[model samples]
Target: MKRIHGYVLLRESNQGIPNLLVCAFDAEGAVQDLLGARRGAERPTLTFGKLGKRIGSVLTGTDGAFELTRDDLHFEGVESRPDLVLAVLAPEDVVDPRRPVALPPEQRILYISAVPRSEAGAEEAYVIRLQQAQLDAFGIALDTSADNAHKRIAATQALLGDVEAGTQIRAQVAGRLHGRLKTQHRREVEFRDQAKKAVQLVALPHGLRAHPLLLSEASKLPDLQKKALTEGIRHLKDAHRPQLRISLRAAELRTAGMKLDRRGKPIGKINTLKLADVLRNMLGGVSLVRKDEVEPSALSDIALRARSATRTRARGAVDRAGEEGQGKALAREPGRTTAKAVKSATPRRDRRK
Candidate 1:
């Protein structure tokens, strides 16, 4: 049995940031947790098999000290005791509101005590000093030596066999790459479809009519409709793309109603109105004739044209606005006619009936 205790000093100025410490006894537990394991009702014990081993671990309290004790010692192989501690402390100076800077890196010193079975009675105190520069160097070495070397050797071996057999290695590599790319593309498409469904579930019918810009981008079709609604309104004003603007406006009118008052006057409630408001706003404000009030028939024709444009341009918006049923109602209305028919019928009827 052996007992070891030490303190890990995380050198950071006392400001206002909390400190984090991580420690593990065995490789499995350490790798599984990555940081630290959650506290449970029963703490798991490390088992040493044919290869005799002993493992113990405990973290520091608010005081920054930890302890490790082993009742039975068995294994002799190397056991890694990796630990990381971070402390965030606010600086003394007043932080600038305009330009914010990243906090300075903290320094750490690890003090460890080990009681090896080979030297059972001897208690040794070890201090491990580490800095950012040293850690960076170690990381670079591991990546270049282990990771790069392994990848290069494997690729060389794989290509060499094909080359010796008089095979077209380049073609084979290209084919494999193409296959992987196709698989990735399919996955992306599936993910996009799933996302679009999720958005449609939350989007209100009115939002679609108010913001047509959302329907312009096919890629954005998957986002939650509410999110799309907000984006559509925002970009619609300054949008220079003619095709995109037309698509967005059409979608907005169809999905969300236009902004209008009860007196059939155009209003600035673009923020509130749905697809219906789009038609109301466009037709409501326009006076058919200058000298006297416009005829009801002429007003009805303008409304019909506006509604048709909105439906044709933005079916998604119309669907969201809950106006799909309204299309049938509008069609059933008497004296309803296309813009061309309305134009030709007016003067002829005046001269005849």
Candidate 2:
């Protein structure tokens, strides 16, 4: 039944080293809701979210001051705000020093630590730790063969076994890893396909069907059309691996069609025209640009259309004005008097004769 909550504070260092800090509040303490738009104050019983368990957790002291060391530090990627979660740990969940059952969550502790552990392989341990934490916190179970097995395999699969057991265990672990990979791959493909169909495409290239428009990246593209092209390519390519052929950048972004008048004023709107959608365009074929290339300003599809329309209107006006001038000159020619005036002049001349 014990619980705690807190806000994460961002501490920046000039040297670019990763350090983490969490300002945990009492179980019923008052704090602003960082996750909300209104950010109203709430006193939730469990604020330290589930991920709090894996992150830097420091024990509280008698003086109400929780000290943290470099060992308790690790950086998580960007968060809307620093927030903690609640842990309803049973008394038996006492193995972790961070969650000592003897001390309640009211101490309002801060967690920090130094990560001296080096990465074992290609991926950094910290990144994996963060991803694992996320998966553990909000993971769903699958009723696959792995769960149906009656074998009570624990410790990430057979840790202690006979002399020949090492090879067998390694093979078992490899099989499990392969199974996990296949499941992940299947889910990723399904999700990507769904995303592609859901979004109204503003621009799509032929070759790179796997990659879709990244709205987060596109919104940052420059506003001018000339610049939107060059800069959009640079930003898009930078987001992925150097070798990844991002055939289209802003071009793939979804845009809202802004219906505009001849004066460049918005006469109507297309709902999808977000900032990023306008900076890119889709052509008959995909545009290719390397990460080392140029940058451009942002412009919307509506704006481009409006600009074109305005130019067309101006040209038509000039043509109409010339036709009207010629018509006026013909009406003002010398023998062009009205019928009544001509009759009056002839009658006076006939009477005198």
Candidate 3:
């Protein structure tokens, strides 16, 4: 069995903390927790109370170097191969406060994977490197389809064959594309619904139902409320796209200084960002541009309408105040019908008779 080594370095000058958690999914798809907390530094192995299982300790150095020194956690072994490897870096563990968004422990996990050739629509395999900044700025998620490329090609080829048999290719392509977009849109709506459920909503005294709140506004809440939002986003991501198997930019993956495998596919080390990160940034006020305009327009319009309504109410209050003040001044003027004068001038003959 080949021994595998993993290294985690803090390259930024004043960015992240040394504390981290490295987790993996075994061949059987069970999540195996690899401990990296400071409490278990001296101990050779730490035991989990719930699982009753012991695993090797992952240690960190004083200079912000985190390494899995033991070869016991090999990725090449028959039974030890991992389907995915992820690193969890919590908000507290991150030293930089300059970032626009901060994610909770569960949502902060960065997926590290080598995208296969078939998935990339290429003859050779490549690794994609994603960072926190890219995810924060663009709000783009990693495509996590296993064989989406092949499926698309097969569909297109069948359409071409139909064209040769006298069918209109352009119309067929348009129909297929429209169907795919509708499915994608539906999934996006479902994901947002799940995310909103994670937020804590407060009930209003004036109404029977809870107060209406946007996910972006609810995400600004403190403590447990914020945690719930992040967890909800992660759950949605896990269900929709579990693996980061999307095609990436070729310019980002360099050919030079890369080690090739027996089949000539480049196997290189790359950093990663997650789709969950995109959600975090979006809720944190980062503007996201998507291929479909309706999706982003729906969210931005909600916030816009809320702000507009607030301004309208403020203007109405000011106008009412001014009108009341003018009316009181007019009543105080000479010859005006004051409350006492009006009552005194009223007919008293009926009462006297």
Candidate 4:
């Protein structure tokens, strides 16, 4: 009785028969003859109203079989393209053939693309568009497979747990050294430096858990080296907590992989950071916190010395100012100025000529 528009979702429901539905129109307007239509069979250009929203071609069995289905059309709401739809899959809605989908406010139809595609050039473009929409809006592009959502979530939770565990271990190790810093601070300079390198070895958050080589490297860290690193961290932390954080970050950079763009890097590739490479990079970064960290007492001494120097300079400046003022006053008085001028002007009898 009425003409409306929607996208055609052609999917195999049973027995290799692709059930076709125009999402804009209800089941009454659905094209069910797709089962009889060949894969490349000629389908009509279906449109509705004056807007001419492309509902895609209908692959009907007979030349005019589509007309009989179109005649079954009734008053149902229509939309152009993949307009978000309300999906109601409750038990009541499942049992009832006439139940309208209930869309709670602000809820969206999930990733299932209700947009119909022609059998030709539409797939790749639609895929790219969907990927872009997900990435741009949500800060992540999820795998398009409908069945992989739970697996993806599980993998994410596992990764987060690993990161947290790595952080806890790193903290525990650092704490053990910090508690005994007073006793261990006098370790040999070479030993301390080696310990710093050792800390860098274990700083790789992801690699530590993911890479077998890294675990071996961690297990091989000598006790002296470990102690040295703990002492270094404690000293740096005492010197400046921020410096310690920076050192840890620098070490992290050497040992960890950066967030890679999806376009370039393959997913699930574990980055192999070598112990030698980590040691080399650690020489620069791990020592920085130790070097930059100034003791609180040393800082206080510097302040005190600076203040004393400043006071001395101020006193000298005051003396100079006083002399300048006296000279200016004498110059302002005409008689005093003349007397001084005459005294200087009088050719000193050149006894030492």
Candidate 5:
């Protein structure tokens, strides 16, 4: 009866429809194999531990919402096995749902455990937001078709076998992908430099994931080259163990709400004002006081300043004008004066008298 319950909140903007698999695997020596499972000749299989098992699966809602409950999970022995770890399938490894996904012969049957650190409990609430940029890196397109649902389901079943293999595969893909993407960027130094700066900014607790300088500069790149660099940065982030390995329950707090205003209240529709702000908060660290704000800079400042200085200046001018008006009014009507002004005036009046 004891198990974890949660929701996977995909960003409303992501094009891909991610199918989540609740998989269980042994947390022992099998980690190595699991990390490289996506590249392995055979499906990811656990060694020296229980074979990976798919407890449950669900396709995300149109709004990118999917729920996971005890009913979704098949294994009841999760609590008894401390070594048993559950993972939500990573987007990269997901078969593209838009078309009849024909993964490369070698890449097919590979599993990527994007988030694999959930524990079994009576009831736990988790909300994970999958970014559009990251999905693009994985080549997962948005699901626009209603007929392709079964294709994805079939794809999911094709890969299910052992959990440990999926777990280990992500680690290797991260390393290999980093080298591959960097090599690709080497031909274009500009792309590499921008990507490097992005990496540094994104790693900070208060980093802006989408700074204007990067965006503007990237916008100028050839479409293919720009996409390559963007995906490169995403791969690096997807590989980061701290962000990747952070407990799912904690991730929920980090990536909450569909769309929020400056005050962090949910709005009726998508708010572009808070889009980058929300993304910045989700990547590096969660800030309760304020989201990461990008400063005016050349390369990276994260999100642009949310409040405008022009507005602030306007308010200051209004206050100064009010003070000047008060002084002019006193001069226009000398009888209407403060006690201190009248007190000083009395001495002058007596001398005049």
Candidate 6:
């Protein structure tokens, strides 16, 4: 069988971000030539078409590692230019034809490290570093849970679908007992209070599904509001068509007075009071508005118009305020004031004339 080794690297910026590299050697030694020729460039171009004949492909796991059979040889796409280097063979270059040949670089170890993107300057170094740190912390936790031998053994036995006699039966019983004992427990009273607060801003009397912004606010609702939210999201997504996505945008959340970061990102915290105020504004004009009374198409058009007007007014207000502030500052400066200052300082010669 043919074998291949490869790894993937993810980086936000070019400065200092971690990269994971895994190399596997084929038994036939054909991949060695390809690796030897790989070089580093801004965007390294690798033409697999010329390397060899087309073969099957293998996908990398969530952790960015993959192993492939000889027939599974295919090129892996890289984000940045890869410094593809061959794993140096140790002890012997030729494999024994008498038995199965061991994979070269007998131990295929993967090195996962953060490397900063080259384009990211020192000013952005801190941000990139923090992102890398968060990724690493999550990765470590996942790896620990996945690789636990005891957990794997228990999980495997549970999948067998039959309880045989002897040690296996005892083990299965213990596993089930342990699982039941570990069942999650939480106070429903506390959860209900939180859920009520989350849905408090939602005016069910008004057409919740009509406005995209309102639909977005409803999506944050907890358990009791789930059924309504599901229907609302479905209706909104159908109405919006191509622009609808699984995630909400920061601008959508800003209606609740939850500010976006400098990067225009929302961290999912809701301001209840602000949200209540915005909901009040939305429901103010409508009295007998039922959920089905308003049409999504008309509401979307109104929302777009309102947003445009708001932006225009905001820009004009800023310009006027800036001009007024500049005038005030100029009047207060030395040797600069209104006509009253010049009149008060003038001598009595004006009266003689």
Q: Which numbered prediction scores highest in lDDT against the true structure?
A: 5
**Where does the lowest 10-residue lDDT sum fall in candidate 1?**
13-22
TM-score of each: 0.16, 0.14, 0.19, 0.15, 0.26, 0.16
For candidate 1, write residues 237-346 as lDDT tens digits.
Answer: 77576542322354454355443457845444344445435555666764333686556775787787997888887987767677767776677769776788677878
* Tens-digit lDDT string for candidate 5 (166-202): 8679778887799888877786898778888886544
> What does the lDDT read for residue 333 in candidate 5?
62
RMSD of each: 37.9, 39.3, 49.5, 34.8, 45.6, 40.0
lDDT of each: 0.44, 0.41, 0.46, 0.40, 0.53, 0.46
Q: What's the lDDT for candidate 2?
A: 0.41
Q: Mind sharing the TM-score for model 4?
A: 0.15
In candidate 2 the C-alpha lDDT for residue 140 amounts to 16
How far residue 142's Cα lies from its native spot in candidate 4, in Å, is: 18
How many Å off is the CA of 252 in candidate 1? 99
The per-candidate count of clashes, in order, stands at 29, 32, 0, 0, 14, 16
Residue 79 CA displacement from its true place in model 5, Å:
5.6
Q: Candidate 4, after superposition: displacement of residue 251 in Å?
A: 80
Candidate 4 residue-wise lDDT, 1-353, digit = tens: 22222221212211111122212222212232322344363332222321122332232121111221233332235432232211111111222358666433112212222333322221122110122342233232223342245446768999999999999999998888886775667566668789877874455576456753333445666764777778788887784534322233433443554333457442333245543355557676442334565567766877879979999999999999999999988767455556677777777685345
User: How displaced is residue 36 in candidate 3, in Å?
Assistant: 29
User: Which model, 3 or 4, shows the larger TM-score?
Assistant: 3
Relative to the unseen true structure, what is the C-alpha lDDT of residue 328 in candidate 4, on a scale of 0 to 100?
A: 84
What local lDDT score does residue 282 receive in model 3, on the 0 to 100 scale?
42
lDDT for 301 (candidate 6): 75
Q: Candidate 5: minimum summed lDDT over ten consecutive residues — where?
A: 105-114
